[model samples]
Target: MNETYDKRIMKQKTHRLLEAIAALIISAIIALIFSFLVSVLSSSQVYAQRVAGREGLYRDSVYRRVIGQGSTSLSCYLSYPQGGSSVLRGYGHNAYELGKLGEFIRAALSDTLIYVRSVRVCGYCSVDGNYTSNEQLARKRSLGFMQFILSEYPFLRRYGIRADWVGEDWDQLRSLVASSTLNERDEILQIIDRVDIFSGREKLLMDLNGGAPYRMMEQLFFPLLRRVELTVEYDLHRIIEERYRRKLNDREFALLLEQEREKVRREERLLAEQRALKEKWQADSLAVEETARAQQARAQQAGAQESARRADEAAAAAYRRRREAAREASAARTEHRKLYPLWGVKTNLYALAGLTPQGERTTFMPNLEIEYFAFGRWSLSASALYAYWDFAQGEFWGVTSYTLEPRFWFSPTGLCRGLYTGLYARTGDFDIRRSVVEGVPTDNRTGTYYEAGASLGYVLPLSRHWYLEAGVSGGYRRVADKVYDVEQDKHYLVRNQSQSRLRLTDIRLNIGYRLGKKTIK
Candidate 1:
């Protein structure tokens, strides 16, 4: 009755521990999961845009001019020092032109989306000079500017440049004169038609109307002719290499649209100079050029819109790839964060109960089973126990035993956190005695025994590093023992060997702790 009561008490304590700790474990898990999600989401979100039309990364500097990519074309007009000089002057008329060039160059140089591919400088001289001298002057002017650009920004040399000079820009003069509201505009146009540059064209203009029309042309239309035009072509990185990519947002699209509008306005200005197609003027060719320029502007606008749509799609695709990569990374982290134990130490509650020859439990008994799972699924366990209880004359009952078991867990994790089965062999020595008191005889028994068996068990996790287990073993047992009866302080042997038996050898309900590294999360 007393042993049964003690066994019941141990079971109650185990249940109470489970109830008390489960609530705390659940609360901690909830807190940990919540904090992890918050951190992941916060770090994943990024709020920013591609700077205007371009931004750079370290890889951008090494990327070559991507071939077969779209191109950006730009043209600008500049003021100069003289007809033959290539030098840039800051204080004089050069100031206005330098300021314009500065703003334009800054934008191009800073843009990461494109690289300078080609530069073309076109120089034109006025009609007053002789053809050969004017041609020489224009050539020098174009050459000087091209050399200045290469020297100022040496990187442009990688792409190189082309220079074209117009010796006498009679076309530009005629166009400017036609647009002007000068009193001598009609007479000047007639004079230009009548004389060639080598055949006294400058002399006839000097003789016209006491040189009033000639002087006016030299002052007004001539300055417009003595100008240089610089054209730049850039290679779009997106066309060259997809690695240097950015999403085209509204701001970038608006900037492209404004550039297209500027082209249209420049075309309108040319149209003003080339208006009125009469037989004498023969302006049909100029009209055709203006129409073609307008068509080119339309094509550019269409290309920008298409590029923006494609860029947005590319950005979305890139985001999806990043999310997929993050999930793979998180799975790796989770695997590292969970732990599986390779070794354990445990005690069986049933062993300490009334299951032995003594038929009683004692707190002083020492029982331990050390289990080792060398790999994932297969394991070996060794159990040992020694018990000693003594009182007055011939009243002693105790046991000393050792057991070995080899186990296999069916669980995929092989943590023994689920069901498992094993085979076991055990050997032991025991002594039991009693004194003649209150109708009990003075009987003694000293014995040695061995058993071999198969076992089945289950292990349940009680905490991260703790487990509760139960199993039973049943097979053949062999015993060789001496039985004794004591009378008048003498001993009598009853048998030398007891019969072999097939029976249950052990019953187990164990509590174990895993020993290994701590879990990461």
Candidate 2:
């Protein structure tokens, strides 16, 4: 019972204390309102009269503000550190460029002719992280950057300021990869074109070629991606007409310091505003000049980056050319090792010189030819045909021949095989008795012959050691024939006939062999 009574007593005391505090607050509020009304009423008449004249001064100030205008743009880029949402002001031109943006914006706000409409920042993040986290990071980065701007210029903390965001900028990555001369650019693009969103694409990149390509991209391109763009848009005040233009005089300027009528005071105020606008214009010019300098610097940096990229591309192209040249050189060496012969010997298999004895019937004639390939495309050869065989009495017929030829091959390694042309000179001695002319047995004819001709032939390689060659020679052939009447006498020369003709000298189908190694040139 005593505790309940004590609680009721404390509650009543608490209510009385609350009533007293409320009454004090109401009294202070009424007193403040009464003082505000008294001051406003007392100054209302003079304030209205001064404001009426000040409207014209305001128009004049606006005109001064509009004249000699300069640039009013504030565009800049801000970058963030790798994988972090916070901005790095000192990072990669962010400090200098963002400084220019702030200077222009702060100056624009104070200028009379410009009204800042919006301050916008667009944020982007690289694809190094997950999509959801990157999206949130983009928003946070943009908001954080705007907050930094606002904190720097607290007057900009007004209503209607916003920031937009773009997360995991894959399109930017694709464009960078396309324009870059990366060694694995194709593989990177393939994964980007074919991989799924928020899937194992990043994983594949993390594991590609021991992560070398991914690391390269991260080092070179991702820094550009982790950035934000700031744009400050504004509207300009209209140009005040000529009639509103007037200069402030010395009297008016002096009257600005002394007590005078409202008109003189208004002129003084107008002069002050005009001076303010002129100063603001000067400040704006400086900002514009500074911004232009920054832009020129940025352009130089971009040019340097472009030069570096092109240098890398040229290096890659040179490397590829060297690789191709190396392969071609290896092939050339292998083919050079196949050059087989320096000295060669061959026997003509066809019975050409043996069975095809000219102007006489020879018993047998076998020929041997030896060649020394001086160069792969050139050779010198000597040939001899000496066969003297008699099977019956009083039927002795034989031919002896010697030939020297210098050959030119159609190919670089034609010593072992291919087509060739040669100029040959030959001298031979022969004696024969049985002859046939136009399908009828005629008188015996014997001859000593001299020949000079060009020969063409193709050599087909049967092995590294052996080849099959076929050729025929045609040129001037001279045969000194000792003519004898067949019915008259066996060993009697009836008459001497001089024989000179342009005809086939010899035909050869040779089985040839190559020996010894050639010195490589």
Candidate 3:
């Protein structure tokens, strides 16, 4: 009997070994296939370098000539310097030209979106003629030009273009001078070979050296190289999609209409207030003037009336006080200027309640959240959460977890005030312990899980920097396989070890403080 049992065990062990090997082989094959697919996809991608070179080369050739033709086809519109020779000499001019360039760009893009990847606009002039230091003149010319474009055109505002006031690469300056002489083009190219602009060590390491510096043809062509070149960058697909989809969101559309109506109402109220104040001030002024006239008449008629002088002083004091009060009220109305046009940060602390081991809802626990604002007023936040529930009758009870969530907040008013609702999906790891089973210590375990839920809340300001917020949030949480154990028998047959899924339903009350400016009315 012993011999037969040993044989059976050996045969089972052999079969188990074969199964393990087969599983390993299958896993390797799948991994290899996945890697192959990734490589193929990566090779087909239009990466930054390729796009830059293709677009840069074409613009250097075509756009330069187009500008030479006097159509301003390759310039960014300027807005800041208003208009001047200074504006014309700097990035300001380039910024102005951008709008015109944009029209051609739009046509070129067709259905595609355009993104300005990068713009380096540098302006240079002969240092000999200017009264200012060459560097100082260059800086002023750069800034003046930038300001001109900024003041003239609002379109360049989209690119977030900023000028370098005192930046110069002397090497490039020399290269510019050298390349300007017709006889020295090839000689300058030879000298530039030792320069690191195009063929740097890092570029060589990456096998991306294009092996040449870009020279503006105008300096080599006609009157002068005294100009600013604005490099416009964009991804055709991205810009097209963005422009096409730019629309008022439902809430924003509604809020805009609401704001217009409110504006009209406020204007009417302001007009009424102004009229009332004006009439009151006018009447008071007339009374004071008449009294003064009467007092002066009396003074001329009979020596002096001290009482009349005192009344005149009191009237002046009252008028000053009234003006001061009006100014204070105006300040209160407009003080909370929106700092960020489209971004806000919020911190929230909530008291949490959870079920106990015995199946009773426990008292409040603590939770906190730090959130980031994303596109379309949506937010993604991470939270540290704790839930403890005790029940009088059930065996399972207790959980403490942390979750990362991508949250979407819908503010019906388009302003994050009053009634706002959010839907959040959270997933993370957690540690939990079951109530001591049979009076023995329960083992502590860990697992990864996910939760989904929605929350409704209202933010009401009680003061400029403080607000009272309350909301009810509920979610379904699923905890998977806290622990798994596999055992192999003497015959090498794998035995079922352990596995379980824990699902918890949570409904909690939360009250929080909003730490920021004036409460939204």
Best by lDDT: 2
> Which one wins on TM-score?
1
Q: In model 2, which regions exceed 4 Å deviation?
A: 1-337, 357-363, 391-396, 414-416, 435-442, 485-490, 518-521
Cα lDDT of model 1 by residue, 291-320, tens digit: 545555665778766655554555455455
lDDT tens string, model 2, 19-81?
Answer: 445544643564465466446435522201111112222233332332323223343556556
Per-model C-alpha lDDT, please? Answer: 0.63, 0.64, 0.45
Quick one: RMSD of model 3?
Answer: 22.1
Q: For candidate 1, what is the lDDT? A: 0.63
Candidate 3 local distance difference test against the native: 0.45
Instruction: Candidate 1: give the clashing pairs.
Output: none
Q: What lDDT score goes with residue 479 in model 1?
A: 86
